[model samples]
Target: MTNLQDRYGRRFEYLRLSITDVCNFKCQYCLPDGYLGDKHQHFLSVDELRRVMHAFAALGTSKIRLTGGEPSVRKEFEQLIEIAANTPGISTVATTTNGYRLAANAHKWRQLGLSQINVSLDSLDPELFRRITGNGRHQKVLDGIEAALDAEYRKVKINVVLMKDLNHQQLPAFLEYVRQRPVDIRFIELMQTGLGKDYFDAHHISGESIKQQLVALGWQVQPRGPQDGPALMLRHPDYAGGIGLIMPYSKDFCASCNRLRVSALGKLHLCLFTECGVELRDLLGNDQHQEMLQQRLLAQLQQKDATHQLHQGLTGVTQHLASIGG
Candidate 1:
């Protein structure tokens, strides 16, 4: 099988595909103003997604991660998961969601062939969660996480976008929450999108600080898998769960990049912070274009920048995370 490799020798075996751009939550870092875009915008259909999945899988992509403003918001989400799971050469069908419907649908989704799940839970405190997400369903999300674990998913992860005065000080609480539960809690550094420049400036904290704390607390750094995302995994003997630090601003952060993103509208994004996207919808129109689609995808790898220009305060065309499923 031909692997999707870039000029820098980075081979991508994982794909982050956004099924929809519509989200219900108004997270402070993402859609702080709530979803304002066209709710009826045409996202990729199941057939198109199937072709996309097949093409990538044939190219040695073993994992496909469904992402979105909130991926579970799509009505055809279950079907999408099933399709990804059943695709040839694809061993993992994962998704990242806000846990809105997880409590009620986790088990069903697992049965439908979803292998891994990552829920975005910014804070543990109910009030803080409400404040961060601009919603009052904190308890519901917590219950959803429990449901995901109960469903016996292959792996369960929690995503926490760390902010200085928001939930950065709650590291101890997060650690304790994972002390007994077999979940991986990921602490992501707040990134600067085009629209959240002011907010990012006020809240962005270095993931290094948290890494130092974890080391001091006796957490040992673990090796990353071939297809793992940009998270520095750490584990402790005392805890059943693990800790992951996703520091996009860290030095050599892009050196281990192993994933590529595709927007709901079918645009290939070499980097999350890319200035522009290569339109792939035309090629996805029919199965006849599979060869051309794969060729286009392979050709675009030569154009991928070694690293994103986020360190230069340039967010490129990404105004918000929800736009392309952060």
Candidate 2:
């Protein structure tokens, strides 16, 4: 089997597959206006996703992350997780969600073989969370975390998108919440997407600021696993939980990129901010195209740019994060 290596020699072992673009929450950074696209649009079928997973596994990919506007919103989410968990050569099957359904379904999903989970929890304050996500079920999300822990998940990850004058000042609260929990709180720097130029300018804050705070507070950096996402993991002896900072604007941020993304419609995205994606749905129509599908994926990796052009104020075709399950 061939490895999915790009021109820059970065081996791709992780795939972020979006099951659907339809999200329930109207997060300020992503779909603040809410998902306006057709909710019934044709996303990849379960069989198509199976074929995609097999093709990637054949190419040395061992981790598959199912993402979406919210993956749990899909009717066949459980089936998708089961398929990924049972797929040969796939050792890890993870999913990122808004946690709306996690409180009730965490145990069932865990039993279905989900190995990892990341839930978006931007604010600890219920009202603040409601304002940021346009959802008032903040307590339900917290319960979801507990349910995941009870389900025997080794570690749960909380994704926090830091916004200036928004949830940025609540760092103390977040640190306190994780003091006794085993979850890893990931603070993501607000990114400049295609449609959020003004909002980005108003709210964007550097993750470096958070890192400095962590370092001064006696937190030490931790080594990352081979398939870990782009985050600088750190640990504190006094705290049971960990902290991670995802600073995409930092120097050489893309140098260690080990993952690729596939949109819900089966378009392969080499970079999150790429100008466009290459369609692969036609090749996914049947298992007979497995060889051809792998060839197309390998060919496209050669064309991936060494890095994204976000610093140059270009977001490409990504009008918003939800469009590709950011």
Candidate 3:
């Protein structure tokens, strides 16, 4: 099978498949409130997700990362992981979860061949965590992180969405927390997409400044391997773990964007910040010819935006991160 390559010659091998949009947390920037109204109806079943993975695997997709409003909230979470890992061409299967219920399944997830697990933890302080996530499940997330480490997955990463004046002050503490553990800490720049322009303008923090601060704090930072997804990986000599800065706004993270996102409702998002996509669930559900589906997918891949224009402003995008399976 030929690789799925965009017009820019970027081969798309990574697929961020959102299992479900339902979530337990209402993180201010992700989902200010609980699950959005009626959007969960579009979630794909276990079989559907499996079929989607098989199609992508045939098209040379080597890596699959399951995301969601909170992926663990889905009923078929474990089954989906196994499906992705067992896919013919997929080399690794990973998932990003809020960690609210990860402790209960971390061991099982590792047994299912989940290569890596990324848990979102913004602050070390319990109170601050509660404020950030709009819930008091900070301890649960910590327990989940410990469970993943104990399960001995290849890597366990912590995702911190940096927001000005909101958990931003805890950067040093977050670094220290990961230094002692065998986990990678990723600091994500707040993206001005779907969260409303007002909210983004108020809280968005630059990843560049965060990286500079980490350097001043004596962390020997460097770029990670090409395989290390979009995150700008850095390491400190004294720490057991490394630091990753996902600078969505600092630079053109889209030049090498070798990924395609499929939302829970079956929409194929060419780029995270771009609203352009094709409705893929219909084709997959209709039992259309595999070659036909592949051609349609390739067509959309060619239409993928050269680079996300979030820097220009969130003029056209209105869907929240949850709806899009961030």
Candidate 4:
């Protein structure tokens, strides 16, 4: 099949899939406390997730990212990654995790053909970190990072969600830590949604701020490949790999958007800001829907929006980040 392009002239072949809605942490931004799955909440069984994966892979998706509130928290997470990685035409298979259990599970993931790991590490400050997550175990996350390095995983990227008047003071320290490690660390701007808007300011610290500070520290900010999305992919002059800034809310990458999302319960969302979706859950009734499902997915991509504009009124931004496949 030809590379599917949107009306904006960009291809739509990458997908981020949320395998489950379950998560272990109560991170104020992603999943605040006092939240519980009510009677209406639905989760995709492993087989159902694979069916969607097969359908999309057949439609020319080469890269699949496994995400969840924490995908690693799922019981058959490794098997899911293995299936996606081994799928025909799949060039890359990766996952995003909070890293609490990484130390023990990185090898398991690696053995299953996982390509890259994007782990969330908000702060090195244990107390502040605990407050942010509403859970302890900062050391566990740190250990998981080290274990990924020790296991010689192909690439390890640390995702830091930047919040003002909170952990902004620790940015320099975070950079210093990445400078010594082989990993690529990215500073992601706090997104606007749910508890995030109430907990964080709309202002996002730019890649320029990070570049300037790196220069002050005597490190040259060298650019990296592709240069898509929120990450201002850059390498350091003396450091081994690089540092990245994914300032989405501060610097939107709406025009070059090259991805789609499949929610945990078989809903396909075209944009992060769009509220409605193309429900594939009904297709679960029969294998006859596979071909039609592929067509529906393509039709949805044809109408993909150029930008999220999430900062604007979120009257339609209903799905939680986890449910929407972050």
lDDT of 1 by residue, 250-317 (tens): 99999999889999999999999999999999998899999999999999988999998888899999
What is the lDDT for 39 in model 2? 57
RMSD per candidate (Å) reads 1.0, 1.2, 1.7, 2.4
| lDDT accuracy of residue 74 in candidate 1 | 88
Q: Candidate 2: worst 10 consecutive residues by lDDT?
A: 222-231
lDDT of 4 by residue, 1-326 (tens): 42556788876667889887777888867787623656387677777777787788887878889998688878889889988988888877888998988999888788888888999888889998998888798999999999888877788998877776677679667867876899888877676665465555543455567667766877654443352444666666667767787656555466557678888878888886677877888875566788887888778878777777665746255545666767
True-structure lDDT of candidate 2: 0.92
Candidate 2 has a TM-score of 0.98
Model 1 worst lDDT window (10 residues): 222-231
TM-score of each: 0.98, 0.98, 0.95, 0.91
CA lDDT of every candidate: 0.93, 0.92, 0.82, 0.76
Per-residue lDDT of candidate 2, residues 131-242 (tens digit):
9999999999999999998997756899999999999999999999899999999999999998899999999999999999989999999887766667999999999999
Lowest lDDT 10-residue stretch of candidate 3: 314-323
Question: Can you write out model 3's per-residue Cα lDDT over 90-126, one digit (the tens) per residue?
Answer: 8889999999888998898899889899999989999
Query: What would the C-alpha RMSD of candidate 2 be, to one decimal place?
Result: 1.2
Candidate with the larger lDDT of 2 and 4: 2
